[model samples]
Target: MGTSLLTNSSAMTALQTLSMTNKKLDMTQNRIATGQRVSTASDNAAYWSIATTMRSDNKALGAVQDALGLGAATIDTMYTGLNGTVEVVSEIKAKLTAARTPGVDRGKIQSEITELQKQLKNTGDSAVFNGENWISVDSNSTSYNSTKSVVSSFSRAGGVVQIDTVTVDLEAIKLYDKKADATPLTNVVTGASAGTLVAVAGNITVQVGTGATVNVATTTTSTLDSIAKDIMKLGIDGLTVAVGGGQLQFANRASVNGAPAGVTIVLNGGLTAPAALATAPATETGKGILDKSYDAYNGTAWEVFSVANIDISKLTDNAADLAKLETYIAGVDDALGSITNAATNLGAIKNRIGLQQDFVKALVDSLDRGVGQLVDADMNAESTRLQALQTQQQLGIQALSIANGASQSILSLFRG
Candidate 1:
């Protein structure tokens, strides 16, 4: 009944059918191409939002997994370093034990001990990562780090992640019990017939002449060891002096060898006549590999003292030396045991990280599945939809044709 072309039923019906067919085709293509049921807000507003969130969660979990892997590697490096250090310590212990045995050559042991010290220093100096030394400068802090703790973070899903700093305690390597003695010895001279008196600290060295000098090593705190060397020298020569009771007794030992009178005594290092000589015995003390301190776990702390401090002038045989060495070595062994325990603790931490890595890996897998469920399209369903859309488009075109046929009938009526 409408005259205007815009109001034509056939035209309106065809346009509506075409629009519906295009919409169905679009949905089918989206599912097939994107592999997603909800690709955009227009397709499914709420489902799209949920999928977006799930995808983000998966990314976060993946990141966490990466960081955890790196963390595990870091722990491995630390453990490897500790193991090397332990081997070095064990070698030192073995050498010390051998050195303590009877009939062992102590001179050889000293040489080996010096080598061991060099190795220890090398190990400390060589601890590094990425061409950078890992050794810490912080006092009372760990060797790997001053303040940061080793940590690894993981997400419930596979996503982005971060790694925390690691710290290793290097103090276990230090041996602190041994103390060094740095006191200088005193000198005293006695029994001089005509030489002028020179003052020395509890000891005196009389210089006789050039070339020849006699060295008299002394354990006495009141006397100096070099006094004899000074008074008996090459140039003046022929001069002979005997010293006792902190007194210098001068006699002409010079024969045709020369007149002892030709020698004049000069005191060096502040030696003086009338000086009283005193002696103190040297004692043995313990010396540690490093300047560090530790609490004893099994025995009394060890100390090193000079041999002169002990009452015996010398140990009569290797047997006696071995006994003394054993006593001191026992204390060192105890200290080393504590270090082993600390390393054991680090081992435990490494194991924990291993477990955590496993957990993170499983979590990442789970997150991956969740993200797939959120965004993945069903190919089978999309195939069915494509077939259905084709059928609908065919039907829509046929219906549009039928509506045009009705308009053609109206044209026939107009012809009549």
Candidate 2:
């Protein structure tokens, strides 16, 4: 028998065909098992890159959804605080109403006032969110340290934007009374003579105008305020009283001691004017306005003078306190509404995320199917192809054997 060469064309051709069939079977197996087309860059570089980018986008969207959830929490906290503040204001308004009633005991009103002040302080201090205070102290100057929790921007216009810090002025509502009601006359000498408040011992009368007069008897050391009231009540048009050098001096608003045009101060009884007079008629000063005179804080303390005292009765007139209360209530209401809106928006965003998640999931499934189409083997088809290849492979082996037999036949000639 002759040896067949290792490089025989029949052997090489069968080996090459078998190798090709094996590679195809392997690819089919990989696709069926792994369920992906672009398992590697070697499989399909372009498809793999596209799938990778899509996955990244899905992750990014999920992260943004998480951030929106956090915003919702912050808004919830703010809403709670606003509601509390509104309740406090409502209570204060009620208390104020009760105190304003006629014949109400001053002590009870004072007690209520003190309580109200405490509540106000609490309201200003208690409203907080996210480790921040929301209220700011009210002062003439614009800037100050704030203690209220301020909700900054959480707007959704393409993206969430933060707003500038807002601070509530709690002290803007606090009220106080001012001292010193009347202005005193200036530039006069008062001792025992010259500008003496008393002409003789133990008797005195200060005349404001021709018919207007203030009689002060038996009382000494009366403040300028005490004497000015008598002069004002006289209805003297322009005449006023001022204390200069211990003497009650009469002067007019016009030129020194001169009345307003036709107005005049005429003295009756034993009253007599000093030869020399003083300039600068006394002017009404201090908290002349009623509103500014009352202590808004406790509502108890007030100026003793008229006009300077704020009419506490006015607060109950339905025209005054209602509008003011409503104004404050509206602010709280608006804040609460904003919080609700924020929550709603956040919920919508979350819903969108959920939809996106569902879509992404579906997209992933579709992409997987597409990948399967590219690489996965249909088991039925692969099984049939495998059988065909097996048969061909067997036939190639038989044919190679036959070809070797031919080479054997060539050796038979030598055998003969």
Candidate 3:
């Protein structure tokens, strides 16, 4: 083309090529330095956005892993306590069995049992982690929640994020629950003929909560409702009577008055007793290791007892005391079964948390790989490109120098 001092075409072409080469070399060096192909939105917006979001999600998954770890620790604590309680309850059962011997020193056996019961309480109370105690709790507390939730996973779908949780029902596994109000003594009489008092020639005496006994002639033909009404008519303090489902329920709520008492029903001659009279107080706090009522009938009377309050000290070789001891053994066995089941459940939860921990770690690794694929620079490729660009930049500089020399040649021609 035309050679002019102000606009030399060859020099302009060489300078443009060198400038382009320098730009490419700078870009290659940046990739090598940062070790990323798409470090910013300007490089590759879609991929960068995806990688950024995935990184954020991975952080949330890390938090979920932490939560799972905390939950596992809590479960471990509960399981440890429950397992110890099972051993203590088993020992108590053995003592009750030993007490069944004809004239064994039951008072000494009871002393051992009392120590074991204390151990159970201590275990339940101390099984706490992170201020959370599942074994021993107050169900009546305002902040109490029966279901405990543990964060297990964080997921994103269609740009929406959600956290998943694993739940444990404390109600099914708790060993003790303190109540705000005292539970009363209850007697339930149930059978096909429970609601009917057959006409006979005797008197029935009912005494409730230190109140005066009420006498009602057995000859009076009465339904369960009439009997309940008659008992309520006496204005016995803290007493309630209700009849339903072929059953007569009598409750003495004297515990609310600071004195807990039992109910006694005496049947005088010729009157057939109800089919079954379960003389057990309703489940109450401080009554037992487990909230269940057990019946111990001593010929003329049925008494209520529990694993924690059973009086094996009074047991003897007599049939009545033997029967009572049998009931105590059965109640203790039930409590043991409950504790074992709770431990099993806690173990299952621990295993599930372990599995989830593994899965979350795997998921975090996968996300890292995915983000790396989108943004990370291949060092080998970047280094090779860097070498090639440096070579091109040197060649472009030489070509520009040659083009500028053409202007010198033009000056020589003018001088000639």
Candidate 4:
């Protein structure tokens, strides 16, 4: 192309090259400054969008991690409480076992047991974290929930987001419930009507109060009514024996010397005395109030007696009282087993939460690396490119200056 005074074609070409070089230099500088190859939709639309969404999901995962932490703390609290309760219940069991020996001061043993029971209650009540207590609960509360859920993870797939959770059954782990319908103290021991029947193959000696010993002969053909009639023939003051539902019932209705006198029925010759005769007498001596009937778990299917209500203070060395003591021990054992199972389950959950925490951390790191690969700039490469583009911009400016100087040559010709 021929040169023209107005056009200056060579200068125009150099000017265009310089402008393009400056734009490229500006872009390299921006990449270095932002540390991102795709900082915006204009840089790389698809990658920027993906990184934005991933960042949002990472925030959600962070919240899930917090939830997991809270859940772990709650479980740890419950486990600690259960472990302490196990120790206390074990102590109570030992005390009850010791009380089984004849001539042992059961009142002293019962005092120890009472303190242990208080400890159990305290442990249950205090096993709380973040205002949550799984050990002791009021089932009648409007907000009570047997199942507790903990947020575990946040996930996204095909543009859809979801949250995952772990759940625990509080009912299985709960030691006590304060529901109004719970079994009362009166039901701690089996009722008199519910006592074991007197079925023996020999004559049985019965002594009620201070009355003389009476022998009631029993044959295979002897009916409970006939036996009861023979005991009634003793004419003991304030003693009444009757047969009801094939079970013998005994009552002492008389007081002695202006004071209430208790009835004591002693049977020999391997004849099991009716539970009615063993019932806590009106005088309330030689009988513990807690020996009535107590149910743990608030009448759940387990139906074991409450360790907290076990009382051997007034229990004698008689067969019936000893038998009642045995029942108390069994109930405590059952409660211990249940608490142990709950602790095991809580431990497993704690382990799982730890594993999940590790997994979440790893997953978050992986996500960071992935987003980095998609959008983050390589500083080494960007710096090198920036240097090269700056050199190119300088060179383009020089070329444009040289091209514009060609117009000076044309001006010289005109002056000549």
Candidate 5:
């Protein structure tokens, strides 16, 4: 090649090498300072994008964690309330058992029962968490009962993000139905005309003043007059039962208030046709004091406890009322069983929530490690690379300067 001092090709080659080396050095410095291999989309678009999306998913998982915590707290509160209900009901059963003894003031025993029932209501109302009450029916729910759900997981496959949730059945947990606004035990039975008496086989329960539950039954072939015979037998209790003549009524004896506690004379089995009783349900402020469908012999006959079943203020010291108190005690026992089942259900859900919380924590940690793999720069490796690239940059600059001096030597050959 012909040598030309004006066009030093060697200097240009060295300058290009230095420029490339400087660019590499800058990249190493950036990796060291930012501590990330893919800090921008241009660094490694695919890895950068994957890591960006993973970070977003991690944030969503954080929200799910928060929701799980809230659900656990709510369920715990409900379980506490259910335990309280069990205790109160047990106390009520004990009081009813004590009232069974003869010569004891049943009127006073019933007053204590009334107070215990009030405590049950208080327990249900107070078992609220973040304004959510699992045991109490919501007035605004479209259905009679309500259910609940808690966020559990967030996942992304392809481009779509999906959220998973754990659902709980609230109907099984709640104590009162929507219909029982407050007075749960008050039932109104429709009474038939007294003139049309049809006596079929069935038993009648007369409850008064926390006393024994007096049960009277009639045979299928028996007439209303036979039921009257049964009623007369109870007169010694300071209360009287009147059956037949299209009506069944109970009234306090002359010694007591002399008012009727309840009366039911339906045709089909025990339940009166809704349409038939609509016109004339035994009434005192729009409800009957007696449970029309309840049977003294059948345990399942009594479904729920009502607040108006026995009024202490209106009880009489009659033999009939004292006998009816026995049946009431049995009814209370049935109610306790139901509350215990509900509490068990809440406990099961609480355990599940705790497990979900643990899983979420582990998942978050795994995701952080995954994100690190996609973009995190190793400090040990990057720090060493930074030094090596800096040395190459200095050597390349020196080589370029030495190459440019070769042109100056050619100029010296023609120097004066």
Candidate 6:
């Protein structure tokens, strides 16, 4: 090409090449600074889009990891409480076993057992994590269905996001299940009527209240239906009875308008008392008043009973009382066995949760690696490219300067 004084063709060509080289150098510098070969849609649009989508998915995977952590914490909390309860139950069993000795001081032993029971209640109540308790249910709940799930994996399939979860079944391991007491009116008060219990002929003065009383006179031939009317006249809530198995099966309601809600069913049994003026009336010993039964779901049926129906205030050192203690020991052992099985189930669930947590961690790591592969810059390659581009940039500037000097040489050719 021919050169000119105003515009040297070689200089113009060199200027354009230098400009292109500078542009390439700028892009390489940006990549180095950002550490990403595809930072925006302008840089390899397809790769940029893929990286953007993968980054969002990685964030979702992070959330899944967090959820897994929370699930693990909940399981740990429940396991702690259940383990403590097992220990407490074991202690209670030991106490009950020791109480079986003929001369063991049961009152003292019961005091210790009572303390252990309180500990169990505390542990159950406090085993909460993130406001969730798997071992113990709320007091207001009548029953519990224990099942939980944790977010484990997130993926895209068929252009749709699919979330996977890890589930844990804690039903077999629930310890402090809140159960509603079977109401006397709903459960115990049967409509079956019965014959009157006549211990000789006498007027039975039933104390309906603290000071309020009702008198029902029964003859040797008086049927029980006649006596039930007097009980209704007292206006007791859900109170009913039928004579069966040689005893009056009475459902003493918890609420009454009279006597502050405590009722004593003491039919006058002594033969010498006058029907109208019975004195020294025989009182039903520990047979009346409100009672509550606690029930636990044992996988198939409800096991309903109060723990020992314990009342150390009334325990005696008689042989009959010792036999009662033996029965209590057996019941306590049964409770221990049931709770032990429940604890074992909880442990198994805990182990399963632990494995799921590990899986979540591994999945998160894999996701990170995948995302890295999609967008991460190779430092070695980038650094090498950066060095090469920088050298090219310097050479481009030198060439442009040399081309610009070529125009100066044209001016020299015209110089004196």
Best by the TM-score measure: 3
lDDT of 2 at 100: 47
RMSD of 2: 18.2
* Residue range 160-202, candidate 2, lDDT tens digits: 4433333333222211123343433322223344534332323
Q: How many residue pairs clash in each candidate at the backbone level?
A: 66, 14, 0, 7, 15, 2
Model 6 regions more than 4 Å off? 5-7, 98-108, 139-146, 167-171, 177-179, 183-304, 308-331, 409-416
* Top candidate, metric lDDT: 3
Better of 4 and 6 by TM-score: 4
In candidate 5 the C-alpha lDDT for residue 130 amounts to 98
Comparing 2 with 5 on TM-score, the higher-scoring candidate is 5
| TM-scores for candidates 1 onward, in order | 0.57, 0.39, 0.75, 0.73, 0.67, 0.63
Model 2 CA deviation exceeding 4 Å by range: 1-7, 105-416
Ranking by TM-score: 3, 4, 5, 6, 1, 2
Report how far off residue 403 is in candidate 4 (Å): 1.6
2 against 4, candidate with superior TM-score = 4
Question: Which is the better candidate, 1 or 2, if ranked by TM-score?
Answer: 1
Please report, in order, the local distance difference test score of every candidate based on alpha carbons: 0.48, 0.42, 0.73, 0.69, 0.63, 0.59
Between which residue pairs do clashes occur in model 4? 187-293, 187-294, 188-292, 188-293, 188-294, 189-292, 189-293
Predicted candidate 3 versus true structure: per-residue lDDT over 96-211, tens digit per residue:
88888887899899888888777877888999999999888887789998899999999999989899898998866888777543545656665345434454556668765465
- Give the TM-score (vs. native) of candidate 4: 0.73
Report the Cα lDDT for candidate 4.
0.69
The global Cα lDDT (0 to 1) of model 3 is: 0.73
Regions of candidate 4 where Cα sits further than 4 Å from its true position: 182-305
TM-score of 2: 0.39
Report the Cα lDDT for residue 267, model 4: 47
RMSD for each of the candidates: 18.4, 18.2, 9.6, 13.5, 10.5, 13.4
Give the per-residue lDDT digits (tens) of candidate 5, residues 1-416: 76676787888998998898888888888888888889999999999999998999999999999999998998899999888888788888898788776667867887898888777777877989998887766535565335588888899988888898877776556664443221112223334452454546777554443345567776666654455456556543323333322444333212123322332223333324222212222322111111212222111122322432544334345544443454455446655765787778778888988999999999999999999999989989988887888888888889899988876777777779
